[model samples]
Target: MLSQLMVLFGFFALVLVSIFWINKAVRMFDKLIGDGQPAWVFFEFTALTLPAVIGSMLPIAAFAAAVYVVHRLSADSELAVVQATGYSPWRLARAVVVFGLIVALMMSILAHLLIPNSLSQLRMREDEVSRNVTAQLLTAGEFLHPAPGVTFYTREITPEGELRDVFLSDRRNPGSAVTYTSSRAYLVQDPAGTRLVMVAGLAQNMQQSGQKLFTTHFEDFSHDISSLVSRDAINLNKLAFAGTPELLRDPQAVAARTGAAPGAVMAELHGRFTAALMCLVAALVGFATLLVGAFSRFGVWRQVLVAFGLLVGLKLIESAVLAPVLVTAALWPLLYLPSLGGLALAVGILWLAQRPGVWRRIANAIWPWWRRARGAGA
Candidate 1:
């Protein structure tokens, strides 16, 4: 069980990492590269996001490992011998339960600690990159787009960081466009932000509807830097940027991070804890679901499918209740519904596994209905 769990975890990690990296690479590369940023910036931005990705993947990895190992053991009759040796269904599931708890603990650490820090770092890095004028602009002879619909180009950049023959276009406003051409310009850093100090510049404004042009020439001009990049909210607006304590403390304030209600952050806090619990829940779902029936040499693939189906159903339930829970803290109990359901299901399955007579009674009650349904389908 240990060996299989380790192997499956590594396997799942590689598969998930590759999928996430490939999906993120194109966008990250273009976002940095289109802005004419360097390769290292591309790598750094994508790398920082990986912890959140890995954190989300851990539960599924644990689930898959448990299912695969249990199904394999049943197919090999290893589980039957273990059961014959007086290990009850739940007792035989001890290794899997231990593995599940270990994974759950790891997930708790990540959800409560590491993922938020990584997300915070990613947010800060993105903000810094956007604010960086040297990286985004100041490249001589190349057109630079500091923001959407905004472009700047300089014919030459001196070693002293002076811009010569600058062309700047600002079209961030959908109704009108502004363009600037200067003989000389240099960026000035202030507490507010970076500003362009242009000498001997010509400004042209054109309205989008009328295409009316207005031109002005000045010996000196200072343009505010704020419009050159996207402005983020004063506070981090991502739930992933806050830990459980941050989320629980002043729930309303943290909920503002997601523009949600007072209970939103509380739901998030409870969700993180419940999400960790779900790792164990998912593992037990796999273990218990597979243990119910007699062994099949062909494998317990049918039971595995049933377990997966149950998990999917529980996830759907979780999704359906999340919105209400976020709005009403009284509904916070819904956050644990899936985990509790899984636990109940595991307990129920173990009971059935222990009592073959009861299982026989259940099969007798429903087996004919199943056949009828199958016949109707056929």
Candidate 2:
């Protein structure tokens, strides 16, 4: 129960930090696209973004938090007392790993299934907003930019789709601009249900060629623009798609990308295993490293420094390796290699710290070699 509570709190802290990080990115994107809404609306948007963030960061956060908690317990000599009472570190680590497994599986579900569906829904909502909105509600000027490239101006517009004094400038590129002016224009839908048609009573246009410009006029014209989206399910790209089950179902694709066998899907299939295993690895490393510096007594700040360095270094290497493995070899080295390495390092360090005779011999082997060189120089 205590371990579970710690994990829950750790997850909460990790989520808060992730959300704060995302808030910065969200504000920047909002400014870029001018999608700012009221405070309540922004809060809602952030809430929508949370599941995605949790899906991505939960495992790492769980690992880090587990490591920290274990280290703290060890530092306070709590582990020694527990062990005196016949509770082994490995046993505790098993519990941590179990917790990690649960979180990992939940994350996979969110990442693979929930997030994708939510994103598609959000897109559909935005599309509906853009499509059904009236030109007057969207723009109120002789010239208005509803979207980036299209410029529209109207002298008169009626609720019944009658548009008079319509002027449009399409600046899709440089050195060529198409200008259209119609005495009257209206929107019409095709019975085929394939397209929306814009019918015009009279139309005029000016086409530009370098420094030269040519103009033309017509009595009737029509225009059509494909809808923003058609009826199709969106695919979560390789990076964002989560869940080992789905990845396993399509083994050929994953194997082709990573050069690994279908069993490699276990990484995604058992994300919690990976995360909990990572926590155990980190706990072993953190405990041993802290003990090594115990006499020096560097304290929490020092532990924080070492932890930050180790975590950051591991992350950099993992990200660098993950791309190639997933892209070409189908080997997920990033997911497992660091975990293994951490575990090995932790075990080695713990053994060395516990066995003083072994440490002395190892120290002597290096010191004598250094002294021989100094003696010769003197």
Candidate 3:
């Protein structure tokens, strides 16, 4: 439990750091868009998106954390006593499963519950903000700049559609300076569509020395303003939102919407299960590698690299090859073959870790593939 807690806290910190780095880059683009909001606004907006980030991060965090904890104990010579006492490698691996279960529960909550609800709320709040009235969008005392060439200042705005004093300057025009002020003004939307309709109690307009100024007050003035939203609509039925249960029950529906065959959902659903099961697989792989070779003495780094390589290879294959098969083989579980392969590999590794001479047989089969991987990486 303590290990689990440590890993969980470390994962959260990792996610926070990643989000901060992403925000640093996003803020630069947001500044160019001139949203009349501060950097903190973008920060808050980005921070609320952590639920989406949590799901993808969980598996990698679990794998890295498991490797880190296991290796650190070994490096400090803690595992030597356990091994000398006849604590089998399998028993040692069982301890890691305990931690894996904790991570799995956290992943399930983030993937199936928290993320979907948060995404729904985020979309709703975004819509509300975009539809907000012009008065709500404007600020008092400070010059509000929403675009490169537009500046707005309002002294006060009341809930009852009254503005105390207002000033607007449009600096986009080269030769002339257009300044407008009014004692009291109110804003309305275009009755026809999405446009701003401004109506004033009194008005004054000045232009650069083109014979005096024009004053108008009797009724209304109107202008067009763009809506303030950045992202596309967030629909919850995407593969990520379906969760494991939903995906299992309605593979057809998922296929239709996602344009993948039934195998895609089957693949993804099985993939998630397989991913959770990696705790067992990694433990097997790590233990097997460590036990067989006294001379080869492949340490923690080798164990980590082996696990990481296998995990990444499985993921890349699922994305690049199996993902496409989903569209062609909707009814059949073709995508699940990879998951089956992982399970098979795990079982084989466990068997070899127990039996004599199995490593030589497996090594002969696996060596060529290892060489290929090394070559590709180079």
C-alpha lDDT of all candidate models, in order: 0.83, 0.55, 0.59
- Rate residue 225 of model 3 by lDDT: 51
- Top lDDT: which candidate number? 1
- What does candidate 3's lDDT look like per residue over 302-346, in tens digits? 656776687777667556656556656553455555555655765
Query: How high a TM-score does candidate 1 get?
Result: 0.80
Query: Clashing residue pairs in candidate 2, if any?
Result: 101-272, 258-329, 258-330, 258-331, 259-329, 259-330
* True-vs-predicted CA distance for residue 233, candidate 1, Å: 8.0
Where does model 2 exceed 4 Å of error?
Answer: 4-25, 28-45, 67-95, 115-149, 153-167, 171-204, 207-244, 253-288, 291-303, 323-327, 330-335, 350-378
- lDDT order of candidates, top first: 1, 3, 2
What TM-score would every model get versus the actual structure? Answer: 0.80, 0.59, 0.62
**Residue 58, model 1, lDDT:** 80
Residues 142-175, candidate 1, lDDT per residue (tens digit)?
Answer: 8877778988899988888898999999888989
- Global Cα lDDT for candidate 1: 0.83
- Answer with 1 or 2, whichever has the higher TM-score: 1
Ranking by TM-score: 1, 3, 2
Would you list the clashing residue pairs of candidate 1? none
TM-score of 3: 0.62
How well is each residue in 55-157 modelled by candidate 2, as lDDT tens digits?
A: 5565456555655665666567775577569654455546555565565566556756777566655555445434432422223235765455667676766
Query: Which regions in candidate 3 have their CA more than 4 angstroms from the true location?
Result: 1-34, 37-44, 135-292, 295-299, 329-332, 353-378
